[model samples]
Target: MGCCNAVRLNKCDEYPTQYRTDFIRTGYRPLPFSFKECIKSAFYANNETGNIWTHFIPFLFMVHRAYNVINQFEDLTDPINFGYYVHSIGVTYVLIASTIAHTFCSHSELCFRKCYSVDRAAIIMQGCSVQLVFELYICPPSCYVAEGMGRNSHVILTLYCVLSTIMFCSSVHPRLGRFQRFLATLPFGIGSIMINFSCAVRYLYSSNAIESTCFGTTKGDHVLFYFHLTSACLAIFFYVTKLPERWYPEKFDIVGSSHQIFHIFVAISLYFQNRLIEHVTAEAKFKIETGELLREPLASACSQTVGIFLLTFITVHSVVALYYWKVQPTIQICKPPEKKE
Candidate 1:
């Protein structure tokens, strides 16, 4: 079994060269193609060790945060408040998927690709969940046209999911070059920007359209929102550029690599998002307690929207898996022959 200790250290060229990427410059060791071996690697150390722990540690934090968020809510019946709980679940899913993808990706190319799919799906789900929470809180039924906003939110969620699915499929398509894969993933970031812009517009419009205190009262909220936006952008930039590592490759293989930096930025962004969700939850609860806001029953429209998203997610994964399996034989033939140990 490969490990990261000095005795077991493996340079970039020492591993199966087929798995090498510009980002995974060096200090990587190939793991035996076994689930048990992969799990053991997590403790021994390896190139993927850092990547795994970065997300895994944060995954633990997210679990704790999710629990706290759920406990804070007095009523799980209100959809608006319940949205935060759902958001927590989505975030936790993303973190855990990321951890698993990174930890065991070295086990085999096939495992890596499948895990990548899960990671991408989880990320898209997280983004959509965040958008849903924002739309619900920023343009609550008290301030906006309840029926119209509900429908709009549903439509937006469906469209975003479709776009995300397309992006994920294109990114992993065996035919795509490196540049093309990068381009394929760009839509996820761009879509997020578009959603934020729309939410900002809704906030402004809602403020002008009604005399409700439910929207945009906190200066800190705006600050955290922009901070998160910046963090997200930075994370994407580091990921795309493969910076620092690109400047001086192997030196960062074990630490301070661009991928590690990207993971840190992502964690920071999620922290800000959690804070924002907490702020919104507090506001909603206060309103409910003060009799300024009435607790609305969970909207059937919201349930339908979630169901549509789930269906789309499943369909997309199924199609991608089918395509992979269909072409996998050809892919194996084209790959370089494995060397005998």
Candidate 2:
């Protein structure tokens, strides 16, 4: 009931319709238009409080993990270690973007749309990063260049990045309806399924695998990989369905919402992924020490160039999306309509 830094709190019903999603229709609080006030609200109780903390806390853990990984493997020349470092960076960005989006989305309708675009871009970037790490692990530089499968995998990943960027950009188009926005995210979901399938196939044919430390060879590793896949699937299900909260909206307003559950599952899935990465990295190190395998070179120049291009494209796409959604008044939805009879 009291004010947070002289800014009064609002209830679910007070939220603008444009700001309300189907699952989060209530328990909303108004944020001050000022940047400082909106940021200060992160400390106070509100509808987005759970969402903000969920990713914010994880972002801190990610930072710590990144530091540990870099310190442990100071030699970034090792392709596997470098891949892990890049993955950590990607995960950190995802968490921070999610936190910022949830924290300030209530500031205004334009802010909400802009932040939503940033969150989507972060998701796409994280997905690409995951694929990059997995590819580096499963197919080192020599194998990637020598084998047709590796070449095909790289091409597929590049296409996924391009498609995801396009999808996110399209989702923000004013002409695209709400249903289109929902459909825009479907490609990434499908891409995830395809990626998992590829990993499974590679595991099944481990005898012919180029990498000695292929994941899913051991029964435990297989189970862990499947667990990670299940966690990811569950997160996606909750995100799309907006369950629990969708069934009982106001009851779970400040917490226990579907988005919060999705974030938790995401973290769980990443935990499993980390475990798998650690196991494979250890195995790779043991193999190298035993003279069973040699450390392959890092990604080739062409591969690195492609990666840089994709990163640049994603950056440009996010900038254009923000500009169109926030800075361009003509494209914004808040324009006053002409007088009607």
The best candidate in terms of lDDT: 1
Instruction: Report model 1's TM-score to 2 decimal places.
Output: 0.82
Given candidate 2, what's the lDDT at residue 235?
92
Model 1 stretches astray by more than 4 angstroms: 1-10, 13-18, 139-153, 200-216, 291-309, 325-341
Best by TM-score: 1
Clashing pairs in 2: 12-27
**TM-score of each model, in listed order:** 0.82, 0.82
**Candidate 2 runs further than 4 Å off:** 1-13, 139-147, 173-175, 204-216, 297-341
What local lDDT score does residue 170 receive in model 2, on the 0 to 100 scale? 59
lDDT of 1 by residue, 37-119 (tens): 67877776567778888899988998898787777676666556656666777788889999998777766767766778778
State the C-alpha lDDT per candidate: 0.67, 0.65
Candidate 1 lDDT for residue 236:
87
